[model samples]
Target chain A: MGGFFKSSIGRKVAMALSAFFLMFFLIIHLTVNMTSVFSADLFNELSHFMGTNPLVQFALQPVLLFGVVFHFVLGFILEWKNKKARKVTYFKNNGAANSTWMSRNMMYSGLVILAFLVIHFADFWVHEINVKYINVEPADPTRYYHELVEKFVPIWRVVAYSVAFILLGLHLGHGFTSAFQSMGSTAGRKRALQNLGKAYAVIIPLGFIIIALYHHFNHH
Target chain B: MKLKLKIWRQKNASAKGQMVDYDVSDISEHMSFLEMMDVLNEQLISKGEDPIAFDHDCREGICGMCSMYINGEAHGPDRGITTCQLHMRMFKDGDTITIEPFRAAAFPVIKDLVVDRSAFDRIQQAGGYISVNTSGNTQDANTIPISKHAADEAMDAATCIGCGACVATCKNSSAMLFVGAKVSQYALLPQGQIEAVDRVKNMVAQMDLEGFGNCTNTGACEIECPKGISLDTIARMNRELMKAHI
Candidate 1:
């Protein structure tokens, strides 16, 4: 297992598996975010449960953080090796002819997503942790509802979040089907996988953008 | 037919290569691309100029020796054929064809158009074979019954010529297609099951150690492959490697 992790395809599989974890988490995260538009009480109730639940906080949150760090670190490692793989580049490479722009620019898009993560975690996760641990504030059920409304009040934060989600869409445009392909899951139904990837690439990020926009306007 | 050629010229592995111009005339359409190069070489020799150097073994394209990045494509404009199998008919009169060796960090140019693809050989040496005993009474080859699908897939993988076309055309210069083909060939066969664990583990380790790029599912390798090796082999290899770890 250790040897496998050190191998090229092994590391790639690690990236894919980690990305899949994040992908699943995104769906859950988006669903949670979506509830804010409907009813604050319902959203706050769910957010309090997610926040206070020991299993969610201790186990699932660590796994999620590990996935993010592992995925990002492996991506950089792969990029480094990939760069070294071809010391001399082609004089006139027509890369667009061979692959989708999203597929080709994964590292760049991923870097953008990484930058987005800093802002995202800082706005929500860091605040939550600081309030809970350092500030030693008492548990508040409706805290998430107000936090969502408060965070998007800033035009800059809303736009930045919207742009990050767009970039996330670009990243997932290639990532969704690619994760399937990486794990050797898309054997025969390649076309279907590609279509599904496109849908996910579009719909999920659109959801994030809509969530941000909804909060932006609703709060303003 | 008259054709203008732009060929990369480099004396050795450490030498910098640049495109040099030459012309060949009175070329027959049926002559293979290598033969036209021979004609050009003959002309160069008569003039006491150095002839270009390239690699080739069987002109029939099975030897996996011929490699050229022609006018942008790995094996010229034609699909499903190596440089050796490409006929001059693909070219028209007054056409200018640019030819260069396969470029990758692992495949340094040995001279003119010949590159040292020993990195592939080292990768193969890592774990490309089955350890079934052949000297004495080994397990009867006919005793095992493999599914038709498995057999066909194995044969498909076994067809990889390893001409480095995948590495040459890929934006990352990835060798996953080549390594995948090799891995899939054995992974599908019953004879290969015994060593599957170590085979995938070691082979992949060697491939990474060779400084080859990662596969991003670009599909360039499948499209440009002379053998028409499917990208499925890469997926299968990934599956095999992942399973071995578990």
Candidate 2:
């Protein structure tokens, strides 16, 4: 273990494993979210079910939170170590011209995503738990679902969601391909991974964007 | 072809350095990169100015002493060839080339393009050798029939000239490639297996101790390597380290 930690391969493995864990969470989270686009009632019912579900609330919730925290912490640690290793700085350079813009700016995009998450949770998660919205009634639980859709229907809320989804897409585009490479996939598989990465980069963001637009236009 | 060269000049290790520009005309296209520098130096001496200080011995690209960051790339624009072997044809007439020493905290510039790469020597001294001595015929070379693949890999890793191009090209100035080459050279050979575990541990420790950065597998080292040392060596070193750790 000591040798592994000291070696470059060992560190890459650690990075890959953490990334895999986070990617798994992304898939599950996106699936749960897809329901909101199809039917607000179904989405609210699922959200309420998730909130009340003992298996998820007591077990999976803690695991998910731990995964997110671990992934974010490890990513930053690796970035910090990489920064310390760099010795010289270039002036007016184009070295990163070959790489994706998102790959180069992953840390910044992650920060944006984190900011969006805080706001998202405060609007939806806080209301779900605390019944804090003006129209939400604690005694009448079904009304909470109506209030949730009403909150998302606002033009500003839709715009925020669109911007957050765009950032998330950029993050996933680089994260997915990087995770695959870290796991020892090379050459032929790398091309396939990059293609899949591009697809997810478009589909995932578009999925969320469509959901936001649908809620904003049709319901309003 | 005449070219204007803005080269960094320093009197000593502690002296402040400045970019001193020189003009050298009628240069032959066939001259090696170092030869071009030699022409510039000859001109400076004739003019009564102190010649530029640089390091080069064996000019055959085997000694790893000739190191320079030419126009941002280590050892210049050509790939897989050292500064000594690089010809002047790669540059055109009237080009202003910028030459600087390999910049790294561990590799302080001594004078001009020369740097004290002895840190590499120290890391090697840390644990790069086997304890077995060859005073008397302890064992015949034929006694250990190594596999062809391992022997080839060992030879490839041994091809590393210990040139600091990997360090110069690396954004973090990580010496992972250099250390990885040293580790791989021995790790792949049967004679090196006896001390493989201790070898990697000590070398890696010394590498960090020398204030070198960690490797990020940016592939820049491989691109800028004068000898075309593969990144696979790094992977192999990583594998050996993993086995040792486990």
Candidate 3:
């Protein structure tokens, strides 16, 4: 196990595992958030359960946080080590002649996503924590829907969220199948996996975008 | 045809390098790129100047010895051919061509346009071979029947000539494509089953130790490889490593 972790493929597999976890978390998060579009009562109920549940707050949340941190740290470490591999830079490199732009710029997209994560935690997670633990406020299940709608009211926040989601789309565009490729899953199923990845990359972020726009426009 | 060339010139391993320009006229469209270099070298030799150094063997593109980063692409703008195989016709008359050696920390420059690729030899020595008995009891050639699909795939992987073009073209200077081809050439065959686990583990360990970067699935290596090795070989190597760990 130690040897596995130390190997190059092992580190990549570890990255892929964390990516799988985070992508799964995104699906669940979007599903929960999308509930606010139709019925406020259902949205508040689900949000309250998710927010107040002991299993989610104490156990799953910590794992999700660790996964996020682990992915970013290892990603940076890989990028740093990879950079050191080339002591001299190319005089004229035609990277686009062979590879896709998204494949080469994962770190940049990742940085954008990281910035959005910080703001997201401040806007939602921090406030949730303050209300539940720091302020010792009484539980109000009905407040969840109103709180979500209010956050999307400001045009700046809406624009920021929309831009971040689009970048997230670009991140996932290459990352979806890339994670699978790292896991050695590119056998006869490559075409299927690529198609699935394309759909997933488009749909997940689009879902978040629609929710944000829907709330921003329909908050009346 | 007349051409302007910017070629990297370095004295030795410890010395700094810079691009030196030269003019060569009357280059034939039929002449190979290396032949054009030969004309340039002959001119320098006649002028009592130091000739540029580069590697070439079998100029037909099989030996994998010739390496040149021409006009931003490995082995020039052409696909499925080494620098030796590239023809002068690909370039326009009087065009300025940039040539540099394959640059990677693991592949340090020994002189102008020459890098030490012995790191690949070390990685191969780690576990690139299978143990065979020569005690007059050698197995028959027909002992194992390999499927046509596996045999063809193995042949494709075996086509790699250790040219280092993949590393040159990769954005991260990753040797995964080369290593992957090496691993897959064996992993796809029945004869390599005995040491499959150790082969992958030790080879990968040596590769990491060599300071070659990791693969980001950029697909540049595949497009630039003189042998046109597929990225599936990389996936196979990953799978082999996973199976070994399991």
Candidate 4:
């Protein structure tokens, strides 16, 4: 396992494995967030249970945090090494002639996503921690839906969250297929996986955006 | 046909290089790309200036010595052929051509257009061959049989010409495609089963030590490879490495 972390493909495998973990988190996250539209009581109950569960707080949350940091830090390292590998730039480059716009600009999209993560943590994860652990606010299950609705009601926050989700979709579009390839998938299965990845890229982010818009318009 | 040429000129590996422009006229359209370059060098030599340097041998395209980045594409704009196989007809009269050496940290330029690809040689030396028994007690050759499918796959992989184009064309300077091809050629053969474990391990270690970057699966190397080396070999090599470790 130490040997796996030291090599290049090993680092790639790390990135893929971590990215898949994050992908799994996204599905469950979107599911939980969507329940607010149908019933605020159910959403708050689920959110409170998730927030207060000892297993989640002690085990899963730390793992999720580690996954995010590992994915981004490793991504930056790979980008840095890639840049150094070519000390000199080409007089001309036709990268678009060979790859798609999303495939070529993963770094830029990733940076955008990273920035969005800071805003997200600031508004949600950090706030949740402060309310639950720091200030020792009394448990209020109803606070969950109220806070979510309040955040999206602001037009600027709505636009910011919406844009971030769209960029996340674009990132996943290339990243999904690429992660599978890195892990040794080949041939027709590779193409099928790529198509499925594209669907995942569009649908998941769109789901997040829809949840935000749904709350924004129906916050009464 | 007349054409303007912008070729890279450098004194040595340490000296800074720049693109130098020149004019070559009345050239036959049927001339090979390297032959046209020869005409340019002849013009330079006649004018008492140093001629440009590039690598080419067995100009018929099998030697893998001709490495040129023409108009930003490895081995020129054509597909599945080395620069030596590209003809002057690909360019229109009065077109300006830009020629530079293959670029990568692992492949440093030796002169004007020649790059030292000895890093590839080193990586191959690490573990590209299999050991054989010649103690006069070897197994009978007639008794050993290789499946046709495996032989065909091995033949496909054995076609890699050791050109640095895959490395040069990769945005990350990744040599995975090249290493993958070499590893698969032997891994699929029955004679190669003896040292199969160490061959991949040692080769990957050497490739990493050479300062090359990781494979991001951009698919550029596959499309740009003159030999049509597939990305499948890279996955195979990864599987080979993992299986060895296990």
Candidate 5:
């Protein structure tokens, strides 16, 4: 592990593996959220199952949280290491002009996404656990979950979610292609992998956008 | 053809720089980009204003001295060609062309359009050379036959002219592609294998010490590179570094 962290390939592999974990979570997340557009009853049922399923809730949730934390930690460490390698200062010049806008701005975008996550968890996760599991809402058991979706229905909320989702899409687009290349997946099928990346760049954001618009248009 | 030029001007490294506009008329379409600039400088001198100070030598584009960020793209808008090779016909009459020095924290402005790319020289000095003494008693040309594939790849990597376009085009200001090319050139050959580990480590250390950013592999450096050196070189370097570390 120390040897891996010391080498450039090792750092890249760490980043790629962590990113893979996050991508897996993204697929599961998008699928679960998409169910909300079909029926609130079905979505609620799924949410209830997710909440009650001991195996998934106990085992998977901790791993997912660990993945997010580890990914972020590795990203910052690599960025800092790169910065430390540079020695001089220039007056007015664009540095590393060949990288994507998303990759370059990942640190900033990741922070923004983190802020959104905080608000997101507070508005939904906290309430779900507090009201449903804790038995705090004596009068209204499903009120918190319904209110969470209601917040998403508003135009401003919809716009906020859309913007966040777009950032995620941009991050994933570059991250996907980068992960493949980092893992020594060069030549032949690499082109196919990059194409799949480009497709995901468009599709995943579109998925989030559709879900946002669906609730915005169909809900109150 | 006539063109309006907005060229950056600075007295010295510490001085503030600004874009001073000049109009040149009847420029021959046959003139190279540097030649057009020469005409503009002559006009500036005749008008009693200081000539726009820019770097150029061996206007054949081999010197890697003609560093200019023309119209937001390094070495103007042409692909796989240096600014010296870019012709006047690429522009039209009355076109407003903006020319500035390549921007980077490491590449300080020495004068208008001329930057102190000695940092690159320093990086090269760090470990870019193979220390072989040839006192006219060296081995024959066919003594060691390098494979055609390895020789081609080495030649491709050696094609890098140390122009700094890769750094200019990179968003993070990374010099990985440039350094990678140099490292790959030597790493692929038997002559370079003796010091492969030390060569990569020293060169990469120098590159970082020069304040270049990390590589994100956006392919922009390749696109804007006058030599069209591929990002694959950087990937190869990364692989080499990984092997050395392990």
Candidate 6:
């Protein structure tokens, strides 16, 4: 309903729904990227399929992009509104006395993630788009693996990605259970869900980190 | 214990406020924080100076009228207690204590260390009650049997004192915990089911209209709450709101 999107709870639910979509996208992306560790042919095959498939490029890609933009725009708006709620500042607020550093500083962590996203898009997506659509270059399935490995060969790029992944871990550390809590989940399963969230936060980012580090070292 | 105090002082709602320092000596550690304030006021009155104004009714902590951001906390450094219940022993001799009003756009400072909490009352008035027929025949109270678990949880939600500590301590000044407690206390009961959808929708609408921030699930409210009201109540309210939409 139109009214639902206007309310605070409704807006929170909308944020949570977008977060869920983005989190799911991470898993698929990581799985595909992980294939590069084993065989170049397999990685190339998967990359070519994902990069050129009509369903992916034309349909799901736009939805994913929309979800990312929607999440960030709404997040910034909510942060701005929250800041306006308190006109006067507290002389001394001990926020750590009651809440986690990450929970309170979501906007900052999200900004870091946003910065990384730009670099990520520039390094890979823009190039992919140019190769496929703009330049209309001939399809070379083997080009995918070499390009990905080459990106990780630079130390600065590897370090930047590693730092971004660590912050991503921190972002998901709170955001995972937070998203569920926003969905109105009951307390009975809270402990289990939080544990699951912790594991996910660590594993997802660690997987990406290992892939980055592995490529940086093994690109002989 | 002898201590230095820095208290916020303002002439009126529109006046500029500043922290004024005062020294109180020969104080006993056993005295309640408010009693120490009383001593300070006594000293001020004898000096022909105006006493710092603050809010407190039931020193026993049930009235929810007592509010002070003491030393960067809602109710001093102690956990699960209001300002009136905080004892002087929490601070040491020669310690300088800082006291200020609860800061929120919705809770404007009226004078020295006192804020207008009428925003909470308005939110409650919006939809915090259930409809009951009382003209002729009233329904028997014992007719409905509620599970013990539900009854206890409802009672827990009912324990919110409306002290605004949750709002004061929250980084975003969000009042979700307070509104959530009000909504959950009723949504759990069959007596409250008839108006359930409207209750959540209206209360949330009023809460937003009052300039309270959206909850980011920081869990600060639950930790700072005197009643230890859980974040589950907030989740329940979210669920209720979602169900209402559906």
Which candidate has the highest DockQ of all? 6
- Lowest-sum lDDT 10-residue window in model 4 chain B: B136-145
Q: Which residue ranges in model 3 land beyond 4 Å of their true spot?
A: none
**For candidate 6, lDDT tens digit of each residue in B146-189?**
99999999999999999999999887788999999999999988
- The regions of model 6 sitting more than 4 angstroms off are none
Using DockQ, rank the candidates from best to worst: 6, 3, 4, 1, 2, 5
Residues B1-246, candidate 3: write the lDDT tens digits: 999999999999999999999999889999999999999999999999999999998999999888889988999999999999999999999899999999899999999999999999999999988888989999985878999999999999999999999999887888999889999999999889999999999999999999999888888999999999998999999999999988
List A-chain TM-scores for all predictions: 0.96, 0.85, 0.98, 0.97, 0.88, 0.98
In angstroms, the error of model 6 at B137 is 2.3
Clashing pairs in 2: A1-B245, A85-B172, A86-B171, A86-B172, A87-B172
* Candidate with more favorable, higher TM-score: 2 or 6: 6
Q: What is the TM-score of chain A in candidate 6?
A: 0.98
Candidate 4 lDDT tens digits, B1-246: 999988888889999999989999878989999999999889999999999999999998799999999988899888898999999999999999998889899999899999999999999999999777779998875677999988888898889999888998888999999999999999888888889989988999999999999888888889888889888899888878877777
lDDT of 4 at A44: 95
Q: What residue pairs clash in candidate 3, if any at all?
A: none
Candidate 2 shows a clash count of: 5
Show where candidate 2 strays beyond 4 Å: A1-13, A39-42, A58-63, A66-94, A97-106, A118-129, A132-220, B133-135
Cα deviation of B77, candidate 5, in Å: 1.1
Tens digits of per-residue lDDT for model 6, A1-220? 8999999889999999999999999999999989998888999999999898999989999999999999999999999999999988888788888889989888988999999999999989999989888998998989999999998998998999999998999999999999999999899999999999999999999999999999999984
The lDDT per prediction is 0.87, 0.77, 0.92, 0.89, 0.78, 0.92
How does candidate 1 score on lDDT? 0.87
Instruction: State the displacement of the C-alpha of residue A149, model 4, in Å, after optimal TM-score superposition.
Output: 2.0
**Candidate 4 overall lDDT versus native:** 0.89
Q: Where does model 5 sit among the CAPRI classes? A: acceptable
Q: TM-score for the first chain of model 3? A: 0.98
- Across residues A32-119, which tens digit of lDDT does each residue of candidate 2 receive? 7788777767777777777777898779878877777776786677678767654445422234422346765777888888888788
Residue-level lDDT tens digits of model 4 in A52-88: 9999888999999999999999999999998888887
Which segments of candidate 1 are over 4 A away from where they belong?
A: A135-140, A150-159, A189-192, A217-220, B1-6, B21-32, B35-47, B87-98, B131-144
> How good is the docking of model 1, as DockQ?
0.55
Regions more than 4 Å wrong, model 4 = B134-142
Sorted into a CAPRI-style docking class, model 6 comes out as high
Provide all candidates' interface root-mean-square deviations.
Answer: 1.5, 3.6, 0.9, 1.1, 4.3, 0.7
